[model samples]
Target: MIPPATAPLFLEQAGWPHAAIVPLAGDASFRRYFRVIEGGRRAVLMDAPPPTEDPRPFIAIAEHLCQQGFAAPAILARDLNEGLVLIEDFGDLRLKEYLEDQPGEELAVYARAIDLLADLHQRPVADVPPYDRAVYLREAGLLTEWYAPATGLVVDAPAYVAAWEAVLPLVEQGSAPVVTVLRDYHAENIMLIDRPEAKGFNAHGLGLLDFQDALAGHPAYDLVSLLQDARRDVPAETEAAMLAHYKAVATPGADFDAAYAILGAQRNAKIIGIFTRLWKRDGKARYLSYMPRMWGLLERDLAHPALAPVADWFAANIPADKRHDALVAFAPE
Candidate 1:
């Protein structure tokens, strides 16, 4: 992961020319990251090339989150034309890995995240794209478009759309007074900071990342993302406890429960397809390992009465036996 040729000049202009740029781990995007060390301090340099990705949304949302007093990374420098940005470093303690080492802290750490969402919902909605019905349907369509065909199944596309058509109105109705929905809010995107001196700076003691895809949508969306995370196993008891915690603290609209179930199913379906696409198209086989978890979570969500139609659609199109990777991963590509 070599930094771009102009990277040195950019760092130099940002006053870190001689800084040692150490490559950092990357995510499921065209973006790459580096830790620029200078003056005994560190900053993250994001290289998000254009046409496939945009750095503007990230910059805008980051500034907004900072203004609202959340722990989003502080933007230190930017070169939008080159799709590069320098931001404050939030160490290597990702919430997922941290919780893996300290399983006892899962409940408490998730409580802080839920509490942060409650506080965020209370603030004004940011200027962002709407997570509208069309967007929801398009996201869910990834399953039919990518996963189903890859699995050698002829899933009924029309039936799939019809199922969502019946359930999404409930989502639209419940998502009143829209707020910022951090579309990727999960254990992986959060960093646990040890800010002993400035703990008050982030009351939750969590650092947020990869939130450029924020949307104005139902508050329950992010909760589902965190609780039903495909990357890690959030224990069933912990999930139940966190749901109760969020409801008690947020006291959202009456339809929160229904929306949570609906969105959870939708999110899991999208993730399943995305993981398949990663393997089939991007040649990223590692994502395939997450499919089983996504399927398990989707099945759990489908148990909700609110998602009856979508559940029926899945049951009819993709049998329980074919709801996983076995049929697809080995299928003729």
Candidate 2:
């Protein structure tokens, strides 16, 4: 993750000329983050270089989340030409690390996250793209696009699309009172903030990040993202309890279970393709370590009755040895 060459200059123009820049992190996309520190002040520089990535969605989403009294990072400065934005920094602590260090807090921490989602779903939807059928097909198609080729399988792509078409209407039924779904509302992306946060929504120091891809989607989408996390192993009991907690806290649609299960399968399948692509195309092998976990999550989602078509697609196409068990023994060249 090379620091973008324009970073120093951007910081200088953003009024942090003398600030020290340290690499913070990079995600699945073309974006990169750096922590800029000067004296006692600090901010995160998001270098979302153009031609591949844009920072506008992230900026707009952050503002929207703030206007709604949620905990997205505050954008301080920007330079559109270089695709750089200086924003408030939520230091190193993330829910994944904190919970790993204190496993007992899993239920409580997850309950808070679920509470935030409940609050969010109750608010007005953000002015963003709708998570419609095209988006669903494109995402679910990743499994065939990347993972299938990587594993040397000839997937029935048309059948896969047909399967999704069959079940996606069920998904639409559960999107009642649609809200902005933060597409990556998982453990690692959620920061445990040390500063005072917004009062409403039970944000309670949970600093949101990586929401540039937020979409006007089903209420269950974010919940599925949180509980069926690919990177973190959320306990089954904790997942179940938090889900019940969400139902108690929010007014979910009658088909919320079907919607949740479908989204879970879709998201987990997307992640499997993504992680596989990160290895085969991007040459990032570390993501491969999370594949088994993703497969496990995907299977759990597949068991739900609503996912029969998609589930059947997987069973007919991705054989068991070529699935999670095979992935466990697989490695990139």
Candidate 3:
């Protein structure tokens, strides 16, 4: 629900006092979104209450994307003091939902999505925080901190950091030019839009959402996020084709295959911990359903020889049999 103080302020800023407000699905953050309709016009009100959530990064990223000719929501009005922004509504057809409804078109849609990435990567990195070793270690640490405790296991934090230190350098070897890595660039955050005549590789056919956490990082990080998605399964063939397409278009010298695997392992590890935290700390048990799929992806990434140290850490700590959902194991029977 929108905060009592925020509702009046949002309506005043948006000039939609009588607009019927309908709550939309929210994300993993403290933000709430509402669809505002008045006189047949529609817009989205993003209620990101301050101290816990801020709208500045979202506004900056949206403007940067728009400047690059991409399809990000336009900010119509905003009250940053109250953490409310009125922005363009892209309607209800998310790529994940659309793919579920039309499985046959998954390849075409994903191809376009890859094309969008290719276009974005070709541009210079936007001004955002670097997704470096420190970030990797901090994010991957969530596994040991949250997932370990939620299960009946103890982790050596110093050793965990040491293992990651040995493994993360592989991602930087033969690195490509850093691009604006939309940290959560996956199917769920992508929207399907109608723009048949949009030109070039960075066509605006796909509407971007949930990019407030973007960073200046290796291009492969976002690729792994897209292919080895936690919330949905992308077909292996599609992943292969997209990877090949990206390699063909991207600048040379980067070992994309190895980087993909290394970063894939890193990302999956962080997600496993994030999902566990969501369940144990936030009481969002639904996230636990994705663990099996995440484990499968993590296992695939660990198969790469570059991830031997981190993989060994996982094998020693989280045995294969114990990699199942913690929520189910710890549930009161």
Which model scores highest in lDDT?
A: 1
Which residue ranges in model 2 land beyond 4 Å of their true spot?
A: 197-203, 328-333
For candidate 3, list the clashing residue pairs, or say none: none
Give the per-residue lDDT of model 2 (tens digit) for 1-333: 667888888888878889988888888888888889999888888989997998999999999998988778888899888899999888888999999899888888888889888888888889999999999999988889998987889989999999999999987875466888999999989988756543222346688989989999888899888998888887888888988999999988878888889999999999888888887788787788888888888998899999899899999999987878455455644
lDDT of 2 at 302: 91
lDDT of model 1 at position 221: 94
Residues 95-118 of candidate 3 have per-residue lDDT tens digits of: 999999999998888888888888
lDDT, residue 110, model 1: 95
TM-score of every candidate: 0.96, 0.95, 0.94
TM-score of 2: 0.95
User: Residue-wise lDDT of candidate 1 within 1-333, one digit each (tens)?
Assistant: 888888899999998889888899677888999999988788999999887889999999999998999888888899998999999888899999998899888889999999999999999899998999999999999999998888779978999999999998987884455789999999999888868743225788888999999999998899998999988888999988999998898857877788899999999999988888888888778888777888999999999999999999988999877775564454334
Show the colliding residue pairs in model 2: none
- By lDDT, the candidates rank as 1, 2, 3
**Model 3, TM vs. native:** 0.94
The Cα local distance difference test for each model comes to: 0.88, 0.86, 0.83
State residue 189's C-alpha deviation in candidate 3, in Å.
0.6
Clashes of each: 0, 0, 0
